[model samples]
Target: MQDNLPIRKIIHVDMDAFYASVEQMDNPELKGKPIAVGGGGARGVVSAASYEARKFGVRSALSGAQARRNCPELIFVKPRFDRYHEISKQIRAIFYDYTDLVEPLSLDEAYLDVTQNKKGNPSASLIAKEIRERIFKEVGLTASAGISINKFVAKVASDYNKPNGQKTVNPEEVLAFLEALDIRKFYGVGKVTTEKMYQLGIFTGKDLKQKSLEYLDTNFGKSGRFYYYIVRGIHTSEVRPKRTRKSLAAERTFNENLSSEIFMLEKLEHIAQEVSRRLTKSKVSGKTITLKIKYSDFTLQTRSKTLPYFISDKSIILETAKDLLFQEKLQNSVRLLGISLSNLNTEKTKKKLEEKKAVSVQLQFEF
Candidate 1:
């Protein structure tokens, strides 16, 4: 561990099968059955699956048709975003009682810095335990937690004993715990990166630790440095309370594929209106507008334009999408149409950028 880096207590809390659990909780009939929360039609995708369904190899992002094939008895429940948001607020309220340093990753999980909590509890492990108990009692939901010196380990440890369990990696044991972990289990290392690591004979944290910083950078570019330090228990990223919104988008999948641009103009107008409304609600505008098209053959394409000035008006957005739509002929019938706005006005503050720079410099020391 680097002497200049701060040693703090961090806990990552994740809800177990959140959407599926909520469906089962609200309707007792689904409690012990295999259920999926999403449409079960041909083009439908499973947003979440109950644990019972998971035993049959059913999981999120699996197509509805494949999910049904995996578990014939699976019941499909439509997602209730409003209800989930309500429950999420209740869970966050519980977190505020313990600490103000809460960084929510999604509706299901968050990271909390409890070094100096409202309860004056010095033990992060104990605080995590209390938080989990409170969630079960007040919200009637099960949550798992991991306590460690930094966010990276805490995020990974939270998954060690899942569903309804917790793990604490003390400062002294952090090194051994990470070294034994599978490379695939590390956060931010996705499937493609895992395959690349395998090609380089990096299968475990111990194997990764054997490589030099220069060697990692040569192979993995900027991420190589991250792999070098993270394997040594030196992640210094603080738990940020307010994460910025990088982009906003809205899209729709049609019931029937449209063959001509004339058929898509109406759809683009509606999509542009939705995106405009969202931008207004967030009190932000964007200089970049993107139109995403998905063909019936499953191929996808995007066209974007960056204006000199920011815009949030529906008319301007619709005009921009129309121009992109006519930029090229239709290669195939369209199955999905989407409009997204980026280069948002709410960019990161100078303080955040400086903090990131400082973190980069701090991690440059030899292990």
Candidate 2:
């Protein structure tokens, strides 16, 4: 049904091994080493792995023990989230310079709806190139970018060439590109779905496009239509930030490491005030409070506690953050601290959905 909808120009930018790359960039010493960030312990999972590590059968979510077995000299560095966040902000600023239609997927990935842009660059490929160059020059890291007429194809194109790579599927080439792709390469198709498609003799975009719409709908429900359209290089949904926040977070880095409990509590009071204000503005109350901490050596960790009911009071936020901070074994002086709230009330979310629907309808009428 959405295939009949208007077309949109989209770009997907995915930073290659973001955490590991940041580590490599900051300390040239780590550049060529098989590097991984997160989970040095036997049971912990890897959050990111460098291209060097990826060559040795290492990847994000692999257990540290297994990764060690694969590459004995794998360098494990604790994440420096504050610095990473700063880089993310810098990169995102570059996106906004071209188009306000930026949708942040995470600290390292985003979708840009550059149907209309500040630079008036008619080709999305050129935009992706400029953005990648800006990220490299400004952030001291490299990223891969993909451009297409729609999100699904653009997401796939971005991964086609990786680590300082960029790929573009122009309007004329959309159908040909999708037709040649393996069904598994589709953004939403996972291993399980690919297996199913294989059993059904669906291997390529042409195979998927040949399936009757009714049959697809009966088999895959709402997602069937989505699959049917994307296989033919069609996705009408515009690039958008998922504004629904189950969590809100803000953190601060102090010029000097905190050594005194009294001073820590005073700083938390200010953070709590800011977090509470954000919660109030969103009209959302959270049942969970998360405290993020970074030590002097750049080691980072998080502590979270959930309340029985949602809360948005400054005093409650301050008390919870303080409690979590004190509970931690403070072996090192804290250099940065942050408080976040999550698991918001559903009633407010329902209202937001209703408002979003009205806005969508209004936009349709205006168009």
> Which candidate number has the best lDDT?
1
TM-score of 1: 0.92
What is the C-alpha lDDT profile of model 1 across 1-367, one tens digit per residue?
Answer: 7778888999999999999999999999999999999879888889999999999999998989999999999999999999999999999999999989999999999999999999999999999999999999999999999999999999999999998999999999999998999999999899999999999999999999999999999999999999999999999899999999888999988878999999999999999999999999998899899999999998999999999988999999999999999999889999899999998877574457588889888899646
Q: Which candidate achieves the best TM-score against the true structure?
A: 1
What stretches of model 2 exceed 4 Å from their correct place? 1-5, 247-284, 287-309, 312-367
Task: Assess each prediction's global lDDT (C-alpha) against the native.
Answer: 0.94, 0.87
What residue pairs are clashing in model 2? none
Please provide, for model 2 over 1-367, each residue's C-alpha lDDT reduced to its tens digit, 9 standing for 90 to 100: 2446676779999998999999999899998999989776655568899999999999997978899999999999988989998999999999999999988989999999888999998888888899999889988889999998788888999999987899988777888888889998988988988898898889998899899888788877898888887776667677875555678877776757887666788889998999999899878889899999888787988999999978999999999999998895776888788999998876766688699999999999995
